[model samples]
Target: MSELVVAEGVALELRPARLGSRAAALVLDLILMAVLYEICYQLLRALAGSGASDDTVSALDIVSILLVAVGYPLVCETISSGRSVGKLAAGLRVVRLDGGPERFRHAMVRAMALLFADIGLPITLITGLPVLILLGLPGAVAVACSRQGRRLGDLLAGTIVVRERSETSPGTMPMPPHPELARWATTARVEDVPPGLILAARQLLSRVFELDRTAAAELTEELARQVAEHVSPQPPRGVAPYQYLVAVTAERYRREIGVNDPSNGTYRAYRGPRPGFPGTRTGARSAS
Candidate 1:
């Protein structure tokens, strides 16, 4: 079978998550807030009954609100590794714009920003409608214009909320007898493989069950050639064509196969028959 090679330098796909996911998160947050509000109300009432004054009561209310604001993000980040309860339930997370995990400071800044957007801005608009009418428009506009869907706080903190992609399953592709041959069977990381190649490989692999050996072999060979050309300057090195093909195939396999299993070691051997090869030379070789 001809091996499939992915193109170089493909842009990644990034899109806003579905409205349903966002809505679900919002609903969950509201429910949690309601519960907390009731608890705060009861606690404040008890404190007043025990001898607190009106001023104390008002101060406690502000403290309660602040606690809610802080708790939401802190709890989420600690429990779900940077995802709010709502985000966790919806399969979303707050990440840096660079696609890295977000820090607590960033999460806190985002949460505080959201609090201001939801509460402070509304209050300001109510108290000084004329001023808000003239100047508040820009604040809202700034948020909409920013990339990464960041608002003022998000922009300042360098954070963005994004939907998480599901992990690839193990043995998603058929196992090749040789590690070199199997390499072609494996897919590349989303960042490494071009979008077009990833899409093409997926489409081809999906219909692999229907393809005859001759057809599959032809497609694999053509794909291998393309990969060789794209990955040139670092193409597989060996004396024989089969060995070269196996070397290339192994690289692809590492990208595609997500499972960690004992069979992987055996399969790696069959892919290439070259001596002194990094993976196959040292370990147990599979029967060709």
Candidate 2:
């Protein structure tokens, strides 16, 4: 499982498609491409007739090859958001490094690479049947050697193939933000929070109940102290650090999804003592 931390520190766990599954998907795509090519070939032959010249025959072959090899993948992946027929059937999807949908440039690079490297279309055209043995060798080798099971195109395009489904679910839900802190959360500046700290906070919250009581308290205090340095307008007096973290995280989620402050049109700047600043309470008290 690869952990991709997107904006505002939301962690998305994606499983990289394995070699066997990828190969199976490729085979399925090739079978479909072959069928499509055969159809185009027969249609072209009918149009050209038995007395067709060499130039006409060559043009027909080029059109068929390009349509099946390059056009198929490019059109499919671009329209389907990184899923060709084969990938969709195999429950796989291509995504950018940040867990976002694959764009046109990414799909185009992969399609061209598939045509040139995986299918070896140009080489096959030149060498006749002998080059068939080497077809797909580059993609297979690259996938096998890549830690993320990515082919050459994936490396160039900054994309990775991941399973469409995830096997693991969040084990526990963190505490909800304190009701008193709701107003503060609506306008908190959480964009500056480091991804590492957010990930740590999420992990801590998930496992907090499982840890030794003394250890959990100590960790909560230490992590809250670090987090406070980045967040402003420390929670009102007596609000626990855990509650503070939950509130900040909620605010971050709200911001990430482009939800603006519903109550008021503008975000008023915070004037209260920011957490961890001089003259402010530690704000790390354990929640009851």
Candidate 3:
């Protein structure tokens, strides 16, 4: 079976996030909620007075609680840029399904859904059978099952929650090299190049490489065509396909090489030793 892979700095085997992270996020949220509830309850009681009618007092209580439920997520998301206070504290953020930044609408939907999932069912249980509480269970389960730990609300809103990692921890691995010929080239031995050069090249390749060979070739070909069309005069003679590939790859490592020519096509130049040369160590040459 074709495996479902989640790439990190390196291609690691996919695994579900630990439930502890979710629990921590929920616990933090509950603490904030308790504080909000206490403040709101006190304010409502003071406004209504002890002599207020039972109906009036009950209405005030419900309104105060509902307001807390509805507004908490919205306020948190808005202020923290798509992360609730709890999620922020827990080092997590909600992102669009496409791996882009989260938008306000998604935040709203997710916040509202969270309130319903966390509060609505309990309220229904107080007034109805125990089984009624199960209505919200699915929402929680959906979150647990999602790749990004997204709840039903997140799915509905086209969002996902991702944990934050330090800069040292590779955030997202660049797309893998194309599975066919491109993969062969990318998987080439690192020993052939300087350590810094190899690392830089890998970083560039990560961003542009794809796991599918056909797609990689198509992308490279299109890029080559564009370069051929755009440049006023063609590249100097003796720039074979391999040389061009080196040039393109080197260009992607812009910081190291300090050259930017989109017309050079997707490939960048290599600052490392020329290809086909023997290295100091046998293993190094073997790797190349």
Best by TM-score: 2
Sorted on lDDT, best first, the list reads 2, 1, 3
Candidates 1 and 2 compared by TM-score, better number? 2
> How high is each candidate's TM-score?
0.50, 0.57, 0.53
Indicate the residue-level lDDT of 214 in model 3. Answer: 41
Model 1 root-mean-square deviation: 12.6
List where candidate 3 sits over 4 angstroms from the true fold: 1-18, 118-136, 166-288
Candidate order, TM-score descending? 2, 3, 1
Q: Which candidate leads the pack in lDDT?
A: 2
List, residue by residue over 112-160, the lDDT tens digit for candidate 2.
Answer: 8887876566677777856668778778889889878899889888888
**CA shift of 277, model 3, Å:** 25
lDDT of candidate 3 at residue 28, scale 0 to 100? 84
- lDDT of residue 8 for candidate 2: 37
Cα lDDT of model 1 by residue, 79-173, tens digit = 55457778778876665543335667787776676666633455565677553343324334554564444456557677555555431112233
Candidate 1 displacement at residue 214 in angstroms: 40
What C-alpha RMSD separates each model from the true structure? 12.6, 11.1, 12.9
